[model samples]
Target: MSSEIAKYVSECFIKPKYEVQEAKQPYYLAPMDLGMLFAHYIQQGLLFAKPSNLGDEQFSIHKLLQSLKDSLSLTLVHFYPLAGQLTSLMDEAGQKCLVYVDCNKGPGARFIHATLDMTISDILLPTDVPEVVQSFFDHEGAVNYDGHYMSLLTIKVTELLDGVFIGCSMNHALGDGTSYWHFWNVWSEIHRAKAGESVPVSRMPIHNRWFPDGYGPAIYLPLIQPDDFISLQEKPDQLRVRIFHFSSDSIAKLKAKANEEHNHNNTSSEISSFQALSALYWRSIIRALNLAHDQVTNCRLTTNNRHRLNPPLPQEYFGNCIGALKTTTTVGELLEHNLGWAASLLHQSVTNYGDKVVRDFIHRWLHSPAVFKLDVLTDCYSVMMGSSPRFDMYGNEFGLGKAVAVRRGYANKFVGKVTSYPGVEGGGSVDLEICLPPHSMEALESDEDFMNVVSLPLKG
Candidate 1:
């Protein structure tokens, strides 16, 4: 590990307090069609809470770990699939393919107790992505479950000088961002509630996988061969990740500019804040990279299909219900057009995903022979944006207090990929976590148009 990472993980060990398995029966899970595509990737996030709110009397490392372990066991009773492992099986046709979660696996999610010698400020105030924050998660190599199908979740609780960091690593195949947060929220609720106090039914998870009437497990079987694991394209050796904060005012300015241009062109379409900012980031990144004018660049935006589906899936549905909305155009067209033009294209792409379109997408996936592939940035010019600012990142309060700030793990390292989170300061601000080549990032930092909308880093 790098020295920067070593500084945060001063000491770490698995807590043996709640190591026993709690599930009584094996709950087999053949994930939704969309879930099968995400089986290989892991999604992680770090929640940091300041020490002031959780002093020794109210919260100590020992008490926190015990609470987490105990609450996790109860949480898993409801979310039993999490305590299981993802395994591959042969289908009825004797085809060597089918990835499903076997809930019979022993033991539970890995819970680790760690100590960090630094304060929360030292970790989040850094201009660049902090290695310390990344160290909170288990390395990909540590848990090889795709083949053997081991644990689906891992929790690391690290004690800091001025706060506590709760790190979670969840198998993306079992759930998407919605499912991930739903589990955390329930765990928090259970942890904070008094003993014997019932957790609200609304906070519980719904795990029934939904599909078309005739479609069944066979349609969701794994298509990629054992040796054909999907991996991201090669990124620059010297890539950098940084968080750019866009306050409500800045976002408003961007929206106004985009709408003004749309009206000037006599177009009936109006752009949303998400589209405007996404357009701004798309244009800014391409300009910073200085790609060829004729380069065929693409902007891929992830849209949640829960509401778009006909007879929409339950809000608590616990798997991937996401679709990608892509806009393809030459770098010349992107650069030559005003912000409104790009925003219009994005808005149209998102709006086009009605009930019929979503159903058609599901139909196409069910019929395709090839495994579904997550669209990663394949080159310097291709961009993919994910995560929404609407997610309640700061609302998780696990008895200690609400998280002061939240940071995603190293999963966002793919070149040209960006993830957005609700700003720690709240008030309708958005934090854009961007990854790009080092040189491109330097240019983006200096770009007048990009810098104008991004808030300056806060000073103590």
Candidate 2:
């Protein structure tokens, strides 16, 4: 832990409130779950301003910690799979065929409590995100494959002088963003309820992982030793991150501009807010790079496949159900075209990736199960967008006041990975958290076409 972020106090494993045997056999992960094998853990945190009318000396961190840990135990009972560990499942030949979550008395989730010396404004000033935020999460650089031996869930409650940051680090292989937030919602609900009252959540984990049609639940990947993934992790880079806000009005204008310019061709459907904004960023980034006319560029998005499947998987499905969609083009093609053109490319790719496409990708992966590392990075200059704006990032109150802001801990960060969150002001607004090298970030900050639509002035 970084001393600048917090002073380490204590750590303990929080077990389920009651004994549970949800599955007699191991919870075998489906094909989609295995796709994230080498991806970094999903680390995010929420910031809450200190309780009003109370001084730092009056607030007791010990009491709040006890309450949160107690409710977390109850939450684990319902989300039992989170308390489990990912382990290898072997056949009679003693060869590793698949990895499954061992739910039978597995080690529990880790709870860490630390205290820092900073005010809430020190974090929410909208400058380049504070470096100390990375230290708020446990397993800061761990990959999903580490879930084989590491605890699948870790919550670090860092007490600040004028606020608190509740950070969560979950194995990306265990669930997608949807499932991760679902667990957070339940845990916060239990803690928010009246003392000793049983809580009934509107949504609960289905516990069963889904696979494509005609395929069994378990997909095998023989001999997945951790040593094989050491070289697969993201190499360190000199990067800077900043959250840029986009007002709802600006979003609407972008969508309108894209549609008016490109939709007249009658070649594609109307451009959405996400598609339009993504296009704007893509074009701005390409223009900033000053690439050659023939330089190849790609835009990758982690699109949710839940509603794209033919029959569609249930929204409540517990495991990952996402597919990565990539749009490829030359720098000249991307930069010479209007924003609408770039948006259409992204929109078309997303529109084309439907049921048959998803099933076909899964079928191909069934033959060779590999982690989502950098197998394709060498081919092109690329960027990625993830963490949807639809996630209810500010709604988890957890007995504290509503979150003043939401942030990502240092995990899974690469130079062009942009994370989108609903803006603090709500009303369909968005905040894009972009990570880029200092030189690229400098270019982006000065790019007039990109800065024109930003709702607020850039800081730092």
Candidate 3:
């Protein structure tokens, strides 16, 4: 182990404190859920500044771990699917294969306690993300296919000198970013509940997984074993990660500028803050790469399917409900036009993903089940967005202190991949964590058109 990640002690499984009522139901993996079978576990962290009242016993490392474990046990009673392991079985034909969570005799969540020599600034202030931040998470190189025997969810609490990081590795096959944060929010609420309270989780997860009416509930695949279908995503040594923060002011200006032209020229749907920001990023990154203007590129905009389905799944739907709504355009067209032109493409794509479009996607996928691979997602000319700026990042407080920053672990990352988070300042602000090659990173830092709105030299 490196000096930065010093101690690894106390490893155990945290099962539910009481038997769950819904445990009897067969947990289904829908087509959308299984589409991510090859992706890495979603690894992310919440960094908390040490409380001023450090002398109190409640602030001790032992106290924090005990509380986290206890509340997590309570949380798992309701979110028990997370405590299960992925299992594969042959079809009736004995030719095809399928995978589902084994909740009956499953092992619970894996929890690890560790210490680090670094401080909070070691992560947040760096222009280039430090290598040590990768160690804070579990299942560093593990993909979702490994969940067959591996724990579906792993939480590691790394205590630092002046801060602490709670990192979680969640099987991507089980949930999307929405479900991941939903679990985090519930766990935090339980941890923060009063001593005499019953379970305080306000947003209870609904464990009934969904699929198009006639199609799924259990989607079959072409492989016999996960190994046959899985392709490991190797870390790209050329890519460097950088975080660019945009204040609420900058976001509003971008939105106004994009919407101004849209409102002037056309009477379609208005450009959203997210669409406007995505346009800026897509254009800037494409410009930095200096790709041939005529070259074709794409922006894969991550959309939550919960609200887009015909009947619409409730927010509490407890499994994967996400799809990448893609927009393709030639580099020449994207750069030739103004911001409004690019923003409109994104706006149309987002607003156009209603019932018919969503169902068409589902129907098409049912006919051919291929998990998302790394090729189209990592091209230097292409850009993909993950995580949402609307996620309640700072609202979860686990009785210690409010989270100051949200950071991600080293998994499923490649050049041109970006993750967005609600900026700490709130009020429509956003932080974009962009990973690019060293040359592109340097070019982006100096690109005046884009840099003008970005908050430079991110403070820890």
Compared with the true structure, all predictions reach lDDT values of 0.71, 0.82, 0.83
Between candidates 1 and 3, name the one with more favorable lDDT: 3
| Estimated TM-score for each candidate | 0.89, 0.94, 0.95
Q: For model 3, how does the per-residue alpha-carbon lDDT over 1-460 read when each residue is reduced to its tens digit?
A: 2246536877899888888767766677988888888788999889998775745544678878888999888888888988888878788888778788887556689999988877787767767777787888888788888888889999999888889889999999889989999999898888888443358577888877787778766777876455643457566677788889999888899999999977877576789888889999999999988899889989998889898886889988888888888899999999998888999988878777788887888788888887766664557678999999888878988766678888888897887898999888788889999998899989998898899879743354
Q: Residue 71 lDDT in model 1? A: 74
How would the candidate models be sorted by TM-score, starting from the highest?
Answer: 3, 2, 1
Q: Identify the leading candidate in terms of lDDT.
A: 3
TM-score of 3: 0.95
Clashes of each: 0, 0, 0
Residues 1-460, candidate 1: write the lDDT tens digits: 1365523333232222333253443334433433444334455565556555444465567776766777777777677777776666676677546566666654556776777777777877778877667677754533223524445677877788778778887776677777778888777777777454335545667766777778664443544454444343222366688999888888999999999987887888789999999999999999998999999998998778888877988768877787668888999999999999989888888877688987786777667644544454255687888788887767778776667676766754567888888877778889899998888999999999889999864332
Report the CA-based lDDT of candidate 3 relative to the real structure. 0.83
Candidate 3 clashes between residue pairs 3 or more apart in a chain or in different chains: none
